[model samples]
Target: MKALAALALFLLALHPLSSSAQVAPAYHARAEQLLPLLGKDGGEKDFFSDLFLTAVPVNQWRALTADLRRQYGEPQSLGSVRQNGPTAGQVEVRYRRATVGFTLVIAPEAPNRVIGLQIVGAKQADDSLIKVIDDFEALPGQTAFAIARLTDGGPQWIATRAPDRQMATGSSFKLYVLAELARAVEAGERRWSDVIPLSHKSFSGRLLAYPDRAPMTLHSLATTMIAESDNSAADTLLLALGRENVDATLSRAGHAEADAALPLLTTAEAFALKMPANASLRQSYARASIAQRRAMLRDHAARLDAKAVDIGTVAETPASIDSAEWFASPKDEVALLDWLRRHGGEALPIMAVNPGIAPADAARWKYLGYKGGSEPGVMAMNFLAQAKDGSWYAVTGSWNNPAARLDEPRFVALMTRALNLLAETSR
Candidate 1:
């Protein structure tokens, strides 16, 4: 989803900027007012809204703010500020207890407002896949990287830094729901035009935020789920298609360990699984009888509100990352993309709406489909592209670090390099 992880951005809000370059006065004043509140929570009346406030709701604001306090301790000061774009400047933030540094983006247009944020890393972004991954793996945390191409039959191994292993795939798992829905439509059991009332609601999607209770077509829901990684849309589709059915479909599409996502987690269920209380509950459920698990999950699901979720708990600890979340291998990822290319293929087109690859690179292909997922310690990107000769191929990779936040820009830079190489070589 394009939506920022609330805790990631919230933590950036607390940093003190330190820079060798000149900084705008407007940026300083805005940082002073918002930084203190972001450092430790409590002061709410001081928020100023221009673009960000209008885009994110107040409830999300509070949930994220509270989550950061538990993770980062408290903010100390703004360290340095450097202007990047006419409308963007990066600021460094210092936290009281944590050693990690943050890069805060201040909108040049609204110099008084924060626009983007990221965790800085020792290894800088590089175009070379080898160097990039070398830096990534050499960094203090764990990371797995892989790439594959879709053959006429299935994925062909290209390059990999790790063995064929399943890693946590954030919203990329929604592909399972989309695949099942498309299959049902092709079988005449359902229609793409079938209109269903928005059956669920949650954050990480624009559809849930729609003003009117307009019934959207199944096609529309599927589109937004992949295009925007809409949690509500995915949950709705999961309910309609039957979670078990999607789970089976994902396996048939080549997911190695079907049970890894067993009882097929709804976003709410998955998010709750990250919470200390619910994470324990999930473990108990996993050990319980199959007959009792679904009921137990449903009973707990009834009690959850988005606010009840820590939002940061998914990346809070190694124990949590290992115990509660979705998992997929890059090999399995390419296999699914290839399946969509040949069987009930409406999905790839819907995914094409978001080109997760470079534009110059995209131009080399007849079509491209991209889906990405992320939480605190996790990030994933999977692409399905068609060469001009109508040959179908998929390029996919994932990165994880349970101990700390990811260097999002650098990771993306690394993946983009992979995509660029495929774009150039495929032609």
Candidate 2:
């Protein structure tokens, strides 16, 4: 069982067209025709082709307009059309507050009505890297980001804010698990298709309801763990790989404060230990030395099972996030990604299975690999991208607030803007 994490909106798509048909200049006018319908009541039937209407019904199209209005206010003007092919063009619609760009593909024959439409990107007025940073700072809690260009020597910083400061990573820590898995595969110690039994379960993920000890392939576990943030899949993989090996990955991948993450706790343990009923145990575990804590985990392993987790207690304000949750810095994440990109070639496609951003935004990159994590007061997003110019870059950000919950969408939007800016800058 796998439950998908909502990364970003990927709009509709229709049948593929031939590569030879050149986009006619008239497609620009056709692209402009869509601007007026943003807040309009009717007329979708007149503008869109029958095939387009079949794919995206009138009601769904209207609902899309309503959502756009709510987020960016009413549409005002249209930007220039950039041709993609003989039948397709990209156009930007200027809204009351934000600028939205979408792709329009018209039917190949005469009466070239719209056959495909997909929203590709959106940005606030005067949106820039600095503006994005300012928005991150305006958030109520700690927010940090790092955008770096990877080189043969190492990561060369492009932009950074507290890049080395450790913060709760939530599920982003799975990347390390992935790194260690790749190492084992390359070392001939394990194979991706090797089958392993589900050794642990957690409160989150659809895998929680599955029969315990279900047999699954290593590749499937890693895929669901990274794409769906499936806790059980992650724990099963971690346990199978050996925790000490993953801990070794921490140092090998250039983690600055690896000790803070000593004795990596499985998702089940993290949840169970945060339960209100286990406060005394949690306190004791927090105070113990690294060696002592390892012994404690061994002795109390059963008590930290998913059955012991009280969702109500841990789902409220952050529960010992500083001391309990996985911690990583922006720089550490960049290093981890860089290592994966260079050595984990087999895992690259697994990472790209979910781009974690709008399909249009993701298309700008030659290659984009993503894994993000969020829980209550913590949100983290990390990306390993190859720009169209053949340059490799790493971008990562995290937000944490112990006293209150963080806004995931806001953080996502800001990070999206940063990614879009990076794409534009590199080009």
Candidate 3:
């Protein structure tokens, strides 16, 4: 008899007894009733919690407690009840600071507690936290594209198209050109201040129209080309950098698909590639001479497998065919940004293209860099911003919606929203 009694006591102690155990019958019954509501994997706990905590009125806590006790015996403890704010849901429970608590949210027709009890804080039942939950639940399912929230490094939204989809780049390809130029200057192969004369042949349309035709320094031309989207400066820099050097630099940068032998293309040639058959090729060539037009068309024909004459008067340079399809992924773009951040030392001229930064924020953000590209129906912007917190993020967004031809404005809006979202979440 003594041995049996000792064995029973040992078994009882192994399971232990607590306030929660006192209500074991009711809890188990409630758990069974609520199990179905909890869903197959029991993953809807948080969702149900948010619904219940937000749905119930704070003033009814005492009355609800009384009803609960009358129907299912007294609860072990009501825990802590705290108010967060206007936006977030309020909580009322009997709990101590630092103590774990379980929450069970019950809904009508679901005669069981939908959520299993879980640990919570007395102080965390605040309005702000509730608002966060509400906001998350309220997000729309469809968006323009997959966009990364700059603040928290989280992908905040995904657009209809897969985020990984690649598109033709258009003017954004200029970044590659600028990158090559920067690499040359860094390698001591070229100097920032080195001036290379512009040939009359290189002057057509805009370049031909510029008053300052004297030998322009490489630094001036490079900056103007990238920052202003200056086609003439881009062509000149391309010639200066040489096709071989640019191709080698691109290869080194892991742009294996890029052709080094391709000629520097002009905006006119790029536009002409998409021109309709009915359009006048020579008239569309703008100021390009017959020889320049022939050369441009020849290059375009070679790259796109179409007759150069068909492409018309656009002075087709090597830069013309450098579309977005040069094959870059978001991850690749981010990696390139990281490399530039590390090795693009002392080349402030090339790195100064942020279009949307304010002076004050620029000072606070410390390093604000941006690259944007736009063509008829394509728009893209790549950003590298280092915040005051010593953390940095690299973001790139490319939109290719033929129906929506507003590339620059759209890109600016998307980039701004992403940056702002990042700043908000970082805190």
Could you tell me which residue pairs clash in candidate 2? Answer: 22-86, 23-85, 23-86
Would you give me the overall lDDT of model 3?
0.45
Model 2 accuracy (lDDT, Cα): 0.84
The local lDDT score (0 to 100) that residue 252 gets in candidate 3 is: 61
**What are the lDDT figures for the candidates, one per model?**
0.66, 0.84, 0.45
Indicate which candidate wins on lDDT. Answer: 2
**What is candidate 3's lDDT per residue for 1-427, written digit by digit as tens?**
1211001111111112233333434343443333332222333333343434444333332343343334234233343433221111212333222121233322222222333232221122232323332332233321123333333343333222334444445555566677787787788887778888763222223455666556888777767766676667766666568745654555565443333213334444454444444244424343455355546566544443223325333323222222312335454455555556655664443656644433322343556676666654555667666766766666676655444344243245335545544554443
Sorted by TM-score (best first), the order is 2, 1, 3
Candidate 1 lDDT score at position 158:
68
* Candidate 1 residue spans exceeding 4 A from truth: 1-136, 211-213, 286-292, 304-319
lDDT of 1: 0.66
Q: How displaced is residue 279 in candidate 3, in Å? A: 11
lDDT of 2 at 316: 71
The superposed Cα distance between candidate 1 and the true structure at residue 38, in angstroms, equals 32
Candidate 2 stretches with Cα past 4 Å from truth are 1-8, 11-33, 39-74, 81-89, 96-98, 104-117, 209-211
